[model samples]
Target chain A: MLKSAKRFALTAALALAAGPALGGALGLGSEARPEEVTAWDIDVRPDGQGLPEGGGTVEQGEMLFQERCTACHGEFGEGAGRWPVLAGGYDTLDSDNPVKTIGSYWPHLSTVYDYIRRAMPFGDAQSLTADETYALTAYLLYLNEIVAEDFELTKENFTSIELSNESGFIPDDRPDTPGLSEREPCMTDCKPEVVIRMRARVLDVTPDTEDTSAVTSD
Target chain B: MSTSRKPQGGTTRRGFLSAAGGAALAAGAIRPAVSAGPENLPPNVPGWSRYLGSGVDAYPYGQPSSFESHVVRRNVAWLTASVESSVNFTPLHELDGIITPNGLCFERHHAGIAEVDPSDYRLMINGLVDKPMIFTLDDIKRFPRTNKIFFLECAANSGMEWRGAQLNGCQFTHGMVHCVMYTGVPLKLILEEAGLKTNAKWLMVEGADAAGMNRSVPLDKALDDCMVAFKMNGEALRPEQGYPLRLVVPGWEGNMWIKWLRRIEVGDQPWHTREETSKYTDLLENGKSRRFTWAMDCKSVITSPSPQAPLLHKGHNILSGIAWSGRGTVDRVDVTLDGGRNWRPARIDGPSFDKAVHRFYFEFDWQGESLLLQSRAIDSTGYVQPTKDELRAVRGTNSIYHNNGIQTWHVRGNGEVENVEVS
Candidate 1:
């Protein structure tokens, strides 16, 4: 018990001294080595900044995407079950039920490369090799018809590919939404008649609960 | 009333009458008797007072009363395909005060809860930095720590009510938010330790979950108030809340605060990941999508007198709710009794901290009348929470995110409350 207590005291003392010893400006962590940083730094920017040197054709990407992405992303990136649809919603953004896919709404190709490389194959993340990622990117582009079936994607030419919706997004212009910023608290007779437009219970979307009191009323 | 027989088993006429009365009291039909047999009443010693209670550490960890089991997080099962990647609502109607209890906080997980062992955890800082670094759990603790209360709200909190009044309960419509006091080291200090490069303008923060949830935060926001949090409400974060470590971007949408945080890559531009590009962006009526809409605008909701919690008594009741803003503190909360026909300022209670949930109360004497209940919150920036029609006038119904419109509840003469909309 005495030895353990002494060791605890020594540890505390060293920890207290660490802040000052490392330069007194809250220097606490160790210097990270280059290889360690390389192992985890997997992000790719929109300007093709961090694209790894690799190349793949649409044909190679077709096989890889079909084998690894078909379960959730569907046979043709239409999305099976509740998983995300990855392609083909070109002119649907203005429709009632807009299909937001990679080709339809995404603003950057770097997002595609970064997302698939860092967190794809559903549960098996970071398992895709650099070449496999390049292939999948190629296949998704082809599925969206941004590239020909024989188009080969390399780190050098990746930035040349652009999304159709690249210019579709604008920075947050909230409070710019009409009356969003200029709404004053109404005190009397805000409108002529209050109408009931919709009811969630009629839609029957919410899950049922045991408490009968929680049921929606007409 | 008689002196009574033995306080034990044998019954007289008076004893039988009192027993019947007690039974009625237990059924909630009548007010409890001032004195029940006088043996355990205030004038006499109670049973608990006479005996020794359970010893210390009886529960290594304590829990709320079993009666409070109704106070819990609930999910709309139809919202997702499976519980593993679903969202659960906090029982807001059953909660009090601004700080949501750790267990009852709303939960949103992409790949479900990742059980990360603290000993095996590592937070890597890479990309545009003078010297990239990996921080272990101990290394994180060694940094100067800070404690601040902030609200983490999902961008989809009131998404269901975007078109119109949908969910019947406040717990369902507005329960996708929770406020808690987080303990952690600031991201600025950690970045300073690594020394950011001159051109580092954005950061791609990624988590270690199965989905590897990732988002790009503007460098200004990351350096402003973002934190690498390990604890909430004075305890180690619950497994569902990103145990070991998570990022806390005050006032931003919950998705930007990545859970099970593992990597932060400094870059010159936004990564435009799936979350920021495809999901969180709000599509306008004209087909132009609003991107990088991170901050949660000012919003408020009346918790009680809602569907799940209706008026049980007619007189001297407290109408309570929560108000918050991502931009700053909630300056004022006004309650509307008869829809928007009339409005009254509510009483803001407890600590009013920046970018934190503020509790408010408005007491009213209900005269057994049918009422229309609503609340409007104005943040420190003088931004009034917009009405549903006002919001629809601009963004239209094409979007399902950032719905901070006012919510309405109809209280009937029968004392039952329901979700409703008033023009």
Candidate 2:
């Protein structure tokens, strides 16, 4: 107990003394080493700013996808049980039931590389090597019919591969819809009649419960 | 005040009779005798009143009364494929006021909660900076702090109801939001310490969670009101809320406010991460979609008289709900009892803060008449909340995010309420 108390006291002293150490006016944090920065700076931009050096073939990616990703993503990347369909959303962007996938809707190829490398395979993230990620990207491209099955993906040809919806995204221009103005909203008789157009109970998608008392009690 | 009139259990005569009557009714007794001499009545002291309560130190950290156990966060089983990636909603109908209790705040985790130890927590500032720097949790605390109240809303809060009302309760329809006071240092101050490079126009803020969720935030907003919050509601942030650190992008979509924040990489251009490109982007009727749509539009919902909180009282009840906007404070909330036929301004109460939830109430006398209820929020930016049809007219139902359309609740004569869409 005495030793722990002494350690706590020393920590408290160091915390107090750490206020001024860097070039900033407050100088609170220490200079980060290049290695430390590189370890966490994993984000890749559209211009291919942070693509890792690696290469892999679509054939190799098919094997990896079946082994590591098939459980949730399915063998063809169609997605299993709401786990994001990653292929064959080509012409569905304009349909009522749009199927947004990496091939159909994603604008940049770097996103696929970055996402797979940083967070993929669901529970076991950051487990893919750069080569494996490249292979998976190639396989996903094949699934979406964007590339031939024998295509090889590498850092050299990364930016050359563009998506179907590369130019599909526009900046936010809200207040574009009508009826959103500075004018005061009507207080009385805004509409002639109010009729129920839809009811949630009809579809009844809410999770069922044997007892609602616990859920409804106020 | 007379001892002779006082019955056995420290109860006044009238009080004892009323207590007995209430208990009997609750027990579903066929008929309650007013003078039945219940053992724990006013005449006979109540058991809890007579017995000693638990000692002061019984609960080191206090909790709500056991009776309130039912009020909790709930998840829809079909919402996601796995529990770790799923989202749960706050019990909005059962709560009043703007502040959501830390425990009751809605949680949206991409890869479950990251249990980060504060000692091992490090926030690195890299990329376009004069000198990249790493700050420990203690080093972060050494900086000057600021406290502010803000609402963090999921971009997909009302995304389910875009096509139509699918959720039966407000908890599911509009529960993906919460307001809390955060204590932290401004992002500008932290960036200042790092000495951002001249070309730095955007930041790729990443989380340490297993999902490694990341988003690119514009530098202007980072220098504006954004904060790196370590404490929420005056206490150390709950583990589910990013424990040692989280970014507080006031008024922006909750996804931009990265939790379990670990690094901020400055860059000259947007990274267009998976979250920004595929997930949070709003699709339109045309094949084109809207990217980088960060602001949450004006929206409001009626809490009471909703599906979970049915009306139990007939005369003189208060109608309560919450309103907020990503652009600014809610200027006013209009409540329409008979749908769009007529409307009235609900009373806006409590302290109003920028990007924070606003509490509004409307008092009325009900006489068992069926009614259609709806609320419209107008924000300081003069943006009036649009109806479901009005919103669907512009952005197609395919857009899975940012559904700020007005919500409608139907109340039957039996005091039961249901989710509905009106025309």
Candidate 3:
């Protein structure tokens, strides 16, 4: 540990000494900057945090979806031409072909709302206003048959909407002793009774030839 | 004209993984060398350094090397329903300098990539919050933000191990992992804006893809350092990389970071959905399931001198590999030639970015002997790399994800390599 500390100290000293020279070489790129590089995350938390004040209705959302989403999602949100079908998929989790969509598979209504507001309208974005976003959320829920066509989704009625898959997710419980109570943790010298090395046959190269066409945009 | 022939117009390429052979290999031999004198060379430019684009050219977006036209993210044609639903690995043997060019990073998905525009993107926060809020992409950018270089590994990274040794090099064994610099607004800031209700303990994040994949994240970790990220390496993310936005969950499995991020519903407990309950979880020998295993434990793999990286230079070869831990930085790495019979410490190179990739090198002289090469990495928390059988003993053969056992490579005097496990 002491030796490591010494090495770290020496490295730090060298960096400090060369800071000016490096800075001089990178003058324009390194100089004068505020913290404002634009995080632009726009992530809204559960408590109504980070939400824009604007609001939209289900009617307005339908119009926006018709203009931008119909090409891929189909007019009724069933999906078109190699795209994933977005509606109807409730309670098909255990089936051979599980239709995992917003109505049947999504665990929370907030997620549906959040996803549409942030990512919907596919290629053309920011064209939907707050009310339009809310309306679109309602339209998606309606298309999934989760809500009635008359259902209104706005800031006022947002919290009441629930998702069918809400109870499917569970919190992480790996490190707890009680969780692993059936499994014993070695106390004394925990040397292995036997050792098996990694054999080359365990490596997989099939992926080297795999085509990555559908990998979603990050 | 043949399908291979083209107009030779400038083809827009993605990531450029300079084949391990090209990493400073010729310095100036294979590729044009840097002339010592300014005018001595006829404006002799290098391979990647040939195209001289200004910083502004890379401002909005940066592409991979022009020479690396073949390197790309590809999915197995037979794996899924269509091209959009399969996955692909990053060109592990083709990369250099640790920072994987974002364009060539590997991708895994149950559904196809979702195309999300940044303009209409919004995040909804509700459930156990005092006041459920909706924020636009603009609002998310307003909070305090931070940056981190981290390796996101799929739990199914070495899932193929469940069957047998099928691949030759580490590129095939563990290419699912990638390390990159992420810039975003911390989840804590967003949660704080929503004002978590006293009972709020977890946040369920969902994606906008047709599959609508969702997972529950613990609120404690969320508030600590989670990020709603929008950019990777210095540019807006690629369309396949959750374009425009994604959740950045450091040190955790890749599944939790929802792409085309849409919502965060705070709640009192985990939702226990199909992904968490049926798919991602591991089923052990016993009937029980190893559910909710979020953290990707410490793992390591020797990247160079493997099957793909044939023994070019006979003597005094420098072996290189990468080791990382979701818990913290890798403290040490050990390399062995005769399996576990003998081991030596490897030199850790470059900065040990927390939860990021760490490079290690070992210089050894060989007289052309047939040998088995293996590397074991120990993290700061003292977790050591396990053996293949050791991991199989506990998890059983019917499992995938989080396979970080010690990897071995067989080397022949003829300079060829093959997959071989030395027990």
Candidates, DockQ: 0.31, 0.38, 0.09
Candidate 3, residue B5: the lDDT equals 21
Q: TM-score order of candidates, best first? A: 2, 1, 3
TM-score of the A chain in candidate 2? 0.82
Local accuracy of candidate 3 as per-residue lDDT tens digits, B1-423: 111122222333212313332333323223222223343356774444554333353434334443344455545454444555566777676565568888778887656787777787767666666555667777766554567898888888877666567765556668888988888976765666656677778888877676566788988788666898888997787777787789989899998988888767777777655566545766555433466788888888877767666665567888888899898889888888765666778899888987888899999887778767788877776677777677777757655667887777777776666666655
Candidate 1: the clashing residue pairs are none
In the range B1-423, model 2's lDDT, one tens digit per residue, is 112222233365555644554444444322223324477576777656765545576557877753344578899989899899989999899889899999999999989999998999999998888889999999889887889999999999989998898999999999999999999997877887888777789999999999999999999899768999999999999988998899999999999989989999988899999999989999999979999999998889999978888887678888999999998999899998998789999999999898899999999988888889999998888889988888888888988888988899998887878899988
Query: What's the lDDT for residue B249 in model 3?
Result: 90
Report lDDT (CA) for all predictions: 0.83, 0.85, 0.65
Instruction: Please state the CAPRI-style docking class of candidate 1.
Output: acceptable
**Candidate 1 lDDT for residue A24:** 21
Residue-level lDDT of model 3, residues A69-95, one tens digit each, is 888888888888766577887655544
lDDT of 1 by residue, A28-119 (tens): 67777878877777778788877899988899999998799998888899988887888998898998888999999998898899888877
Model 2: CAPRI class: acceptable
lDDT accuracy of residue B245 in candidate 1? 96
DockQ of 1: 0.31
